[model samples]
Target: MGTEARRAGRRDFAGLWASYGLSNLGDGLVVIMLPLTALTLTSSPGLVAGVRWAQTMPYVLCTLAIGVLIDRVERSRLIRWAHLARVVALVLFALALSGEVAPLVALYTVAFLLGTAELVADLGTTSVLPMMVERNRLDGANSRLESTRSSLNEFVGPPLGGFLVAVGTVFATLSTAGLYLVAAGALLLLGRRYDPRPAGESAPAAKPRIRDELTEGLRYLRGHRLLRNLALMVCVMAAAWSGWSAVLVLYAVSPGPMGLSGTTYGILLTALALGGVLGSLVAGPVRRLLGTRNLLAVDVITGVIMLATPVFTAQPWPVGAATFLGGVGSGLWNVTVVTLRQQLIPDELLGRVSSASRLIGWGGMPLGAAVAGVLAQTVGPRPVFALGAVACAALLIPFLRVIREDTIRAAVASRDTRGE
Candidate 1:
């Protein structure tokens, strides 16, 4: 197709987003289901954390390589192959369950492979967005994508997984595997076209040096004052959030002073999910009105609201309420930062740069969760949350100094003028 023709229709972009939205919902279900299945079989917190490692390890280890792959290959073809691999992994899980294999090892292996595919698929999917929309429309388009991901994956995925777990562990994994197959089918239906790359316009040269590519992506992020600060702030916050996630299931199921039971825990999950949905829906408008700086200022307030979760340390209702408000803040933070990143970063470096940025921002999460798990084992869950909250709050002080109006505008304008 001609360049003009490729840019003409919104139909393909709409379909692409729709398919991704559906796929992510399934992805969320898979995320929740794996942990629950492990809990059912092994009943070990570390094992559960280990499952998370299985999922995240690929992102940590393979991200730079995936970025290279995304830039080198056709994004749509890459997505298609990635989804196909996901189907195979899901099928492998089904076979393991059918054959009555040990759920832990089988699921762990599946999670590892699934994470590898997800790394590529996610890079391809997100990197292609800048190409899909007109330059002026990028913010709205990115906002829509973030909203879809937050609402479905973060909000809807957990509760659905828990509900399925309540039904039965094996049944839940099987059901989630089925969802993956459905997502695969959706990807097949979605058209296999993508935005053109600047590098691909000319004859492909020798692939850039890996170290050069990696450092270049980092340099770009560091060059932007806001990006550098935001990335650091998120890394710290991720440590806290990962702690909260590690103990959340345990907290809900505890019989002590502030614990909730099975179905009641599901209710809490549902509330958290609803809060995320509401937060995501409001993100774009909030960013527009507040602009980036004020939006982050609001994020700081929400962080305090999140710290209130400890106030509910003795009751489920208060915990649920705190979680609701925290969800809103987190939702807004994610949408704002993501939109800013898309607006600031160049499309040519979208994959590598995003992967590198994520390395600093998200790379610590699995480690955080692991650390929280060990600490929780010795120190108790409540202390972990309290300490994490205080630490996260302390970390934000530097961020306030880093994120200024000028920095935000410069970051936004960099992409704006470039038509990214």
Candidate 2:
């Protein structure tokens, strides 16, 4: 297709936004319900974390390949297919739950498929966004998207997911399935030809090998010092968060430390989302007043607050408050870093480079989850939180040394000079 043809009849952002919202709403249900379902099947910390790891490990193993795929094809078709696959997987699992046949294996099977589909769909969304909006407006656009993620997935979804699961786990699972189907339908209405190639880039008559494409992305990201440091910092943070999150349900549920009911546990997740909502609301102003480096710094402090509070107290409210702050940290991190990446990376390479960067950032989460299960099983969940806090704190030294006001400015400046 010609460049003019690609630019004509472009994908609608409003339609895309609506689909994104509905998709994440489904994810919110899955995020809470899956772990809760595993708890019903088995109480072993290792097993529970193992299930969680199953869902997220695709980001580690499959992200790099998905990134290359995004750069090569039209993203709308990719996302539509991903959503449909999720619907099928979710419906099967819901049926298994309703029939009382959902073993641990069933949960793992559904989780792995869901994780893979989610990676493709979510990356497609991020990769196409630069085509829809200008660079100067990326921060605002990303903040809105981040807030949608935080709200539906964390705030509205968790409490609702909890309530639905409390009423009937099968129903909750079915509802999530329904949402994915509807989300897929929304994308279908937008049509299938949302080619994401940047202006002036022609399609290759024959596609390059995935391995070659992936190497190009990795080489670009590796050569960029500022992004390299930022990605590394996120890797550390994600690993620590993974360790604490692996066995969190066991830490808070009945006969556990906090003694909260399943429904109330969802409410606790809501508290964390509450912070994210507030943080998203303020991130624009904070970024304007404080700038990017300082905005990024907030996450480390919030990380300590979140991971340490559980160690010092067995109270649910304290953990809730800590998560609220952590949510703020998350909001700040997403707005600053995503915007930075969008501005800096060229449109053609955005999918591959961003995915490669995420490979670096989230690659350790599965490992952390595996280790966390063992630690929680052996020493108890409380010690896992303490260790997570220590690990989160340890990032400060490298973070301070690498990411600074000058480095942030220099990165953007270099991009402008190159006219990327």
Candidate 3:
């Protein structure tokens, strides 16, 4: 029976995995296209920065509500709906771009709407994973998913998006919309029975109060020492990453800075994706070899590279190398952190807790982007990058002090024992 169950689980997981890959590729294409589209509309760094900020803003404002929704509704259905929403947004955006000039306001509005849908899809997909596989195999499953995301979204999609945008923005965006439609279609295969109600919850005994449900998720995170601290550390790291990334495209491609052409910039971006691919592949073995503590410690290498990039080199090759190394660290860090969160959180509370945690962790992204934009305009891109690296380095102190390797291992072991 156990063997049969595992086989069934693998089959289900494969469907979910494919859906994720298709959606992520579309997401990757948009990631490149959106900013470039904004640049074409306006040359103002702050205005261009708004494009990134608008996309991330939904996480801060809507994730808590979405988290509550995920807990109550069918997750697969929610994901499908979210993908459909994105398709609508993308189609509208492509229409807006069909003219000689795409309006900045339209770009911002579309970006925000797309981001709102993404928040739901991302949360649902992640929370749905444990249901598809046995708990023990979560790390491997997450690593595989992360690797796929990096490869398709980061590696293939960016270059393709750049090429498409170079040829024509409207065509690229319409193609991305088509991809989202495909992703939505893929989710239909998960079937109606995929999301069962949480354990101990009675059927439709009046709609649960939103405030109460929201509080439960927050209170759970507050009470759990590891989760609470981890969320905070993640917030800091996210801010640093966002700050650097907000200004990165302009810094790399503009004639004043690195001066690389669109295709070359896309190639440089691929170097980061390639490093992520390598990191995801090695994350498991490296974690086992180095132990959890050292594996996490290695993440600081990314901050170090960010710091060095501005001071040591302005040339594309050297900067690309730095981004590659940072991507490697990011890949390993994501697999480790995500797997740990999955192992620790209760299955029922997973959706709410994941959203709550992300609210804290990812909430800083918009703020960072806004700040970086202002700073870039004021102090220039190099200084903004330098400041971001310093912030990243400072975050390590709290990260190390709060997260103990033995505690994490013990928690996982306890969960396993309880499951048995």
Candidate 4:
């Protein structure tokens, strides 16, 4: 398509992008603020880890149900509602924090509810994307979204969150709530055409049983070889990332480890986001240069860097460098995997399949976080990080052996021939 046509095509996408960026900014702030707030409530590592677990637990519990809902309703409307729900959750959280500390139960409750909204919003927004852009442009579209997310949520959001926390916890919480409201407003600007009903289904039909719909999604994922394999890989990757991330605040800020202050910790986290930005910029060219098969293997590089983070160095600069490199690999992997899924899955089944896949892939995260917390208490944060890295690296062996470029290409070609 020409530049003008592409730009025109992106008109709806611009709204989606802006909404996601705004929401991600709030997410970015919460990433640091939430855990820090949890720490103030209690010093226990397991309880602190529970905060991360709460944020991810909904993926396992609610994703399948959400998948069914997304396919049946207007996805844009669902997204708007999710963001508005998030706004309420954050506002309540801010209110709960009127004192110097919040109750642990309250923190977990808000975290879980916010995560529930996030899961629905993510599923709806992702499913809506292929409808808005050409199939061939999936890579570019995803790259743009990831880049914006990284820049706003990761890069700008973290440090800003840290600063806000330093200034006042209530201020940070309220600011995050305001951002979610803005995100909801931006999503409302999307055109009516954004939500396309599932194929072979009319608007006025009797509601299908949720269990049957959930089973259909599960069966579709179970039957697809490529998707099944990819989901397994995602599961391992999420586990590894979450395991290390669960205790990362303690490792980074506590006097016994890296011994960094809040401001420095935020700056350090920004290194990872900055690397993600670079990775987004390079993903297209790297895909072209490396071919799909090799491109998929980039996670091995990420795994290595992750392993190096705790085992190889305790110094801040080296840790930051490793994080940056890992972020790059993560960026490439996201673009490749998401584009591949978009190409291969039928639009009618996209929401279901995406949710099912994530149910397996992202489901590992909460378990990993909980486990990492326990392990950190028993062993130490460093060993937990090391173990997580090892698991990540080992998981790659099956992926490298099973997934070939020819098979992936053939699958996409076959889907295209069928007009999926």
In candidate 3, the residue pairs with backbone N, CA or C atoms under 3 Å apart (3 or more residues apart, or in different chains) clash, namely none
Report how far residue 98 has shifted in candidate 1, in Å.
4.0
Give the runs in model 2 whose Cα sits over 4 Å from its true position.
1-11, 99-102, 189-192
**lDDT per residue as tens, model 4, 1-420:** 567756756888999999999999988998898888887778888888889999999989999999998887788888989999988887787777885344678789888998899889888877888988898788899999888878887899989998999998889989999999999999767765554565555666587687888988889889889889989888888887888788888888866489988778888889879878888878899989998778778866676676557766779988998888887887788777888888888777788999999999999999899888898888878887888788877876787888888888888888889985
Model 4, which residues run further than 4 Å from truth? 1-8, 99-102, 198-201
Return the lDDT, model 4, position 49. 83
Of candidates 2 and 1, the better by lDDT: 2
TM-score of each: 0.90, 0.95, 0.96, 0.96
Report the candidate with higher TM-score, 2 versus 4.
Answer: 4
Ten residues in sequence with the least summed lDDT for candidate 2: 1-10
**Candidate 1 clashing pairs, residues 3+ apart or interchain:** none
Each candidate's lDDT (Cα)? Answer: 0.70, 0.85, 0.83, 0.84
Quote the positional error of residue 317 for candidate 2 in Å. 1.7
Clashes per model (N, Cα, C within 3 A): 0, 0, 0, 0
* Ten-residue region with minimum lDDT total, candidate 3: 191-200
Tens digit of lDDT per residue, candidate 2, span 295-326? 88888999889989999997887889999999
Clashes of 4: 0
User: What is the per-residue lDDT of model 3 for residues 44-126, given as tens digits with 9 covering 90 to 100?
Assistant: 88887778899999989998899898888778889889999999988887777775444688899988998899889988988
True lDDT of residue 84, candidate 4: 91
